[model samples]
Target: MILFENVSKTYPGSHEALSNVSFHLHRGDMAFLTGHSGAGKSTLLKLIALIERTTRGQILIGGQNLAGVTKRKIPYFRRNIGIIFQDHRLLLDRTVFDNVALPLIIAGLDYREITRKVRAALDKVNLLNKEKQLPATLSTGEQQRVGIARAVVNKPPVLLADEPTGNLDPELSEEIMKMFEQFNQVGVTVLIASHDLELIKRMQHRTLVLGKGKLIAQFPEEDS
Candidate 1:
């Protein structure tokens, strides 16, 4: 569902974050993006979400060229993809229900629909019982699950997560990864950017490794 062709991203003073990167993520594919710090993993995700545009080449999602998308249409286009961050990014003042309802609220859905979708998403992350609690009251793993619920509340076809298990213990990390696996089983295209090599290897999914802005290797070469 995602295609990148000869993509590059450069910032001020010729600082190139990515150089000639290319990959294709077929529908229902789940892959891990592995790289060291400053290896451009986050930059690549931003390009897909349109938070940052590519400096060269093209990006296609579901057959639509992102280069042709206008600035005014970015919000609408982004609704097709769900993004999870390492920090969870929940609003401390809001209840779990409200946090997950944010996307639907912004989309102008009515209260009834938002309520239904929010509960369903929280259920997916096993947070339904915590819906009335504030984000600060939940444990780190629960907080991350809240973030996951919020991201998928809209039922976006593609999910992108960056260092999703960065703060959890191995058991919790495995739990979180299993949640992602469940999502993928139902056909949500999942791409996660994480540096947890051992965990990534354990999962045994396709992985793309980067070094100094280049795609240095793809694991289980048979997939290539």
Candidate 2:
């Protein structure tokens, strides 16, 4: 489970990116974060992933507080949390297989193990046939799938996506959402930041809306 208790962040110039933002996501739950640009959507995810730290309050993932996690321990802490960005962030020079195998390789896994995991991830994204291709060679949607495969290659229990479908058309956007749904079904706690209201409504999952650094509403309302 992920928990945020009265969290807030302020930049060097005292610009508040998030304020007293508190929410809870149970294990295996999938939810959407929606807001306008600079609504703290990205800031919130960054906090959870430790890319940025809260100036106040605390964040806990799976019952462990993130406030005390040191710089040296951040990488290890991140290994179990997968993150996807608006840009696919693939290496244009690398093949899909190589791209997906990067995290495992960095962890010092043997070649055979890397190959097995890479193939399995690619299969999940239905891009096994494109393993040998470069990101530039695939269509926009295919490139995004490659990115998804790379993110999940390590089988992280928590997945966070920021504007994952920002560049895709509506049809492609829905397809991408379905891919997230597939991951959530298999027990990955998923949180996505998106601006597509239509898409969010269509998915019908719990949604947390942020407005100017504060959480303002939740869809379908929480149980009493």
Candidate 3:
């Protein structure tokens, strides 16, 4: 449900992050974005998330042009897209349940609904029992799972993860990828920007590869 047509992003100093990158990710598609460090993977995701504006070209999400989205509407626009970061950005002092519940709370949901959704999200990441625990008390992998739980707690239609498995061991990385796969199976559009080529190969999903500031290749190729 994401389409980028001849999109390019250039920073203030004339550094181009993306150069005419064009791709269409249909609804429910699961894909990976891969490239070397400074290859513009993060910039591409930022453009889609509207965290940064494109220097040229256009981006359409679910048929809505992001260029038309006003600054006042960004919060509402983001409600449909869930983002997970490599570093588990959980509140150090809050319990896992509270962290996962934060988004729902901000959305003004009722307490009972928030409780139910938080529990369900925690269960998905196998962290239901740790709901009362602080982030510092959890293992590295558990902390990452907590991040995932918080991202999906709102059940957004599109999920974007940046280097989600970067800090975890191979086993944990695989586990995290599996969780993304599970979400995709249930129809959540999944696009992950990661540098782990080995892991991306193992997943065998469509991948967009970048180099410098251009889309260099697309694995398995798309049909005409």
Model 1 residue runs over 4 Å out of place are: 222-224
Question: What would the per-residue lDDT of candidate 2 be over residues 1-224, giving only the tens digit for each residue?
Answer: 88999999998886899999988999999999999999999999999999999999999999989988999999999988988989999999999999999999988899999999999999988999999998999999899998899889999999999999999999999999999999999999999999899999999999999999999999867663
TM-score of each: 0.97, 0.97, 0.98
- Comparison by lDDT, 1 against 2, better one: 1
The TM-score of predicted model 2 comes to 0.97
Write down the lDDT that model 2 would get. Answer: 0.93
lDDT of 1 at 5: 95
lDDT of 1 by residue, 1-224 (tens): 99989999998796899999988999999999999999999999999999999999899999999998899999999989999999999999999999999999999999999999999999999999999999999999999999999989998999999999999999999999999999999999999999999999999999999888988898766254
lDDT agreement with native, every candidate: 0.94, 0.93, 0.94
RMSD of 2: 1.0
For candidate 1, the per-residue lDDT at 180 reads 98
lDDT score of residue 199 within candidate 3: 97
Positional deviation of 204 in candidate 1, in angstroms? 0.7
lDDT of 1 at 133: 100
Clashes of each: 0, 0, 0
Ten-residue region with minimum lDDT total, candidate 2: 215-224
